[model samples]
Target: MKRSAAAFFVSVAVLAAGNGVRADGPDEHAGRAQEYILANDFDEARKELARGKPDDVGIATERARLALYEADCDGALVTLSSPDVAKTEQGAMLADIARGCARVTAANVLEEDHDQGVWIRYQDENDRALTPLIIETVVKAREALTRDLGATWPKPTRIVVVRDLLSLSAMTGLPYESAQTTGTVAVAKWGRVTLLSPRASIHGYSWRDTVAHELTHLAVTRATVDRAPLWLQEGVAKREEVRWREPGPFDDRPSPDAIAARGIELKLDLPLDKLGPSIAMLPSADAALVAFSEVASFVRFFASSTPPGSLERLFAALRDGKEPDSALEIASSGNLKQWDTKWRAYLQSKPKEPLPPLLSLGKEPAPNPKAPSLREVRERMRLAELLLARKHPTEALSELERLQLVGAAGAPQDDPSYRYLRGRVLMALADPGRTKEAEVLFQDPKEVLSSYGPWWALRGVLARSRNDEAIAEPSFAEAVATDPFDVEAACETLDADSPTPPSKDPSPLCQSARAWKVPSGTED
Candidate 1:
């Protein structure tokens, strides 16, 4: 929930700083493009490339990276296949994906809640089963975050469910494995979330808690206008992941003993102000772990020792444009310098206990591949998407049609991509007579698919093709707003040019689409 993918990934992308570039340089367009990409402004990153240095290997690599960001492996392959790209370090990494993902049959994207958040993901079997858990988590998170922060999120957030670590990594440019490892269950950045599915937890992380943790990050990010210190952001999110009442049974969370033991290494840590940026830039996993533990512990201390509304006021001060040090002074009558002294004294009073190895609080190690994982469905779907992209929709349909017989058993007939391809093949072949049937596929987008902005954008395209302005207008609007970076959604929304009535009297069709849900999330 807490990590800014931009911060983490841009750092990872910096590894292959091209021939002339070793890191971001404002003087170079390549460096500026990296900055834009890090900020999650892919459109601007492209603009930077267009302005100059379009041939820079580093910049070219970032451009290919953008295609993967949208889960278009084939598109990325085309970008990186060139001789120039093959010579760069990043091109090697991007090539691995483009090569592997060419066999993919399905694809990615998502849609909205009633002013709550958007449910987003690629087309896969888990979509239905994962919907309710995600919706429940987001609703509770929004309510909880609003109460805790005494503020509301400035914009609606997208809750993206990733099918694999690679897709998530590509989107964020953070390495989930390899050298720059982040034991990230989920990340909240640019007012959105990207996470693994329910069973994708690494270590002993609770999936629900992780979702809540990320949503809290989004809320805090908005509250502080992304100006809050890293310590405060991470600490508050870790603490607030659970609704506080009294200390209860271990959910295998970091215990007081574990945290205190971890903190022992930080005996001479920097004062809070100086500590802020260091935590984010720590070079090793061990350092990252210690930073997380110490900050979580300090936040617990600050919340407990402070007056009733002090923490709340602290956030308010930051929101109202106070500097970090000034905000702390105004909120606590002491800045980090004083707080660090108090926290150190508080730590000294704690009793020591034997510390165990850091492991998950759960019985399972990593999830055993006991039964079918998502790989099969995702691969088949990706394959179909690849075929469609190649302008062979009929061939794509042949692949999708075969896909329907096996892996899609529990899947709803209304599944967006499956149904989407049905209509697309019909349209691609110019079969106007069966267009009515194609229209049916986009009609009732299931809850699992509803939050998927691409399907809605697809629906908009389908509707607009037949001059069905009634459906096209709202569907496109919903899609664009749900996933701002979705190229198709953004384009179609503009093309539809849906009337914008006064905010009070909004379109009913759009309202229904925003609140759309599936009939039943389970087989029973």
Candidate 2:
């Protein structure tokens, strides 16, 4: 997805060589390199070139081009350095061209936007007028941060939205390399939010929610500067999104459902002294989700019970370099322990609703009796799900391919789930060559099946591929937490050496565990 011409160039060179005529001159070799790059054969292009030579100006230029294509601007600079390059007629021109390319690539990779002071880019490949909407949302978010946290809020933040996932990922180096990645990602440096196009299509719901979520991260980062704890930052962000969504004035009080869902007894009162420390890091997916959910719930309670302007006061204290506990006490007019007790009492008194039993597919036989005899197409889907559950992703893919053909007649458009499933299967296959295809498919918003356990698990796999352990860990946890029985087998596969699985029971308020079901007729 990170557009590299090196591979393309290499392929063209190989194909040209296969025609039984080797390139004789600098121009011919350079032409071949251009062709290979166009064809996406970077390896072949690199193979055809001579390295570190001043005599071959064409080869040197091609190498510089290849370096730029591969995102190695530094390499490009070094490749362009030659005495012959300075003296030759075309050499100086080629060197200038290479330098310009390197500069643009470097700016794209590292520099923030001059106007907004954020690295955010608005993409409109489909030529949609979504840029205005992004600007509006950012303005609103900024206002909310200023009103709530005043001097503690960071300035010059940027927000980006891409029309397609692949371009977004390629540009941001984010997990999944696309907007179609399951959700939004916040790049801390510029406080940039990258929203995939499909997710953006949800309009009022998806885009606004994502903006609120990412902005909360930005606000918390500013509130604590570099001193914030990871759990606290994530927790506060999660809580703020839900809070901002409530109707009328911004009341700190959480919805009754949120209060009831988070149990009073399980409240985590992590000491400010130990809060930023890494002792709470959980390798197990289940533990991590629980921790995130618990911290989110805790923040919600704290905000709801505290006096008006208390949150603002706390931010002000932090900005003045006060210790966290002292700042909290000054803000609330009491120690955190007292606030904790009050929050616990408030939660206990709230009305409660019993949660549905965790989906127990292991003990109970499959309940969807209609699943077997529905149709050949539906049956294939069922088979694919079963195969995925059994960890036979290859077999599942074969079945899905057949299903895709069968469904092509009547259900051509309703194949997001199929594509999503196939993407997962490919990830499970784990061949490095297939990572690109897998990433592309995963970026399709339609491929994200909210109700499917394996879908989230596959997202986890893709996240891991991109080295995003923070996002991946929670995604894996969501899979197991969504349906403990179905994902129990897969959870075992994640940590075979550990023997005992961490608690798979859903937390009182598992954020992602709450279904992301879109209406049946909705299309992005």
Candidate 3:
């Protein structure tokens, strides 16, 4: 075994090439080196960095972070003063942690567990407890992917769990903002997949689903040379996400009719050809969500309504080098314009079901001299609440806005409880412009006054919507504490809780939570 990360790196360096690389200059050298490091090609990364002999501190910093990746804390610390090292927050943190890492007596080493044809790489023995679950999920993911793709990945598929978004972004070339907006569970590169370590605490993502999602990506990328359009590829991947504990293997596809109904509500819905490049580039988080829903609905509907080989044939076309639109046209046996007409007709024919009742009725508004009485406000609010509860958010929002103008005294807009109601209505409307309004309302200083379970639950919802799950978890906890019966708060908080829904959560506030089942939804 190697004595230190430096020894391990040296061995890899020598194996990659006896001599190191030479570069034209530091900037290009550092950029190429970081690119290699991101790909986990440490040998080439080291070689690339060494080419410059790195007079610049900024260049030296890249080498330092690489050393840390190999757990060579002593080596990493030597370049702590380098400006290149201090260039990024991630680098500064790496420098700060180097000393503590050096003092640890235990040998820093990665552990591997292989079973069947799949293998997982963990940072150390700390993940031993999770290895069994990891292996189980890998096996399931491989099985599910193989079943769908009609091909077995004979070679070992490595699953590498990384430390944080910064590390993942560097490795994958995905920006941190894109990662958060897309709710990226894991990325499947050529030979292996990388996921955020369980320690990173991205609450609410399911490892099982993530493994399944990435496995599908790997298989599909291999099948199509990664040429499949983003929408179809993602639609196929979404189809692969299934809950492991279901009574038996279930398709797990959301009802196309229901999703289409949702699409009708959100006017931003696009046809298969128009789903756009990737979900990450969508204008808002709501647009991303709606886009995914529409594509998933379209793909599943097309498969069921058409011949079984339609999807397989589309992939085949892509494999044969046809463009995405052409492939889609071939799969549907009709042009996209024609398909759009059929899809629209299908959407209109499906039964319309109302969204679940989310708004609670309130007491009548009271009277005041300057404006409408509290009794009048409540009466109008009740009408709006009924509209919202009945799934008429557009009408509800209009009614609520009118109530706000009725008078200065006890205006619904001034009350946190009323503001919360309006926020929810805005969300139900799924309009991007309304999202900011909802955000302002949720962030109001008066939120603390309500202390009600629903109020806190809305606060959690707003936070989670912005990908601020850390803020969300505590609010969710507060909701559960205020009322243990609030299932939505309990479920939303599950991501930040145990890896699996706990049989017994330590918090007395959530004691009753153990008995509730987490509903199937895409948290990962």
lDDT, candidate 1, 302-385, per-residue tens: 888888777778877876768878998988888887887788777776675433221321112233244223455555666766
Listed per model in order, the count of residue pairs whose N, CA or C atoms clash below 3 Å is: 17, 19, 10
Question: Model 2: residues >4 Å from true position, as ranges?
Answer: 1-119, 122-129, 151-156, 161-184, 194-205, 242-289, 356-524
TM-score of each: 0.48, 0.41, 0.48
User: Residue 410 lDDT in model 1?
Assistant: 24
lDDT of 2 by residue, 1-524 (tens): 01111111110000001111122235566656644543335666766664323356677766665664454556766866777555555445445545543443342323344554343444543312334444555666666666655523333455545545344444334333222222222222223454444323222123444466567655654454334445455556555553443332212222323423442233333432343322123222222233444456666677777777777677667646576678888888776667656655665666764422121111222234333232665667667767776778789878877644532432232234555556766766778866677767544333322223444556665776577778567665544423322222234223223222344443322222122323222322
Candidate RMSDs in Å, in order, are: 17.3, 22.0, 16.7
Instruction: Give the Cα-based TM-score of candidate 2 against the true structure.
Output: 0.41
- Summarize candidate 3's per-residue lDDT along 300-389 as a digit string, tens digits: 667677776677778778767787768878887775567667777877887785421111101122444566655666666777777776
- Best-to-worst ranking by TM-score: 3, 1, 2
Q: What would the C-alpha RMSD of candidate 1 be, to one decimal place?
A: 17.3
In terms of lDDT, the best-performing candidate is 3
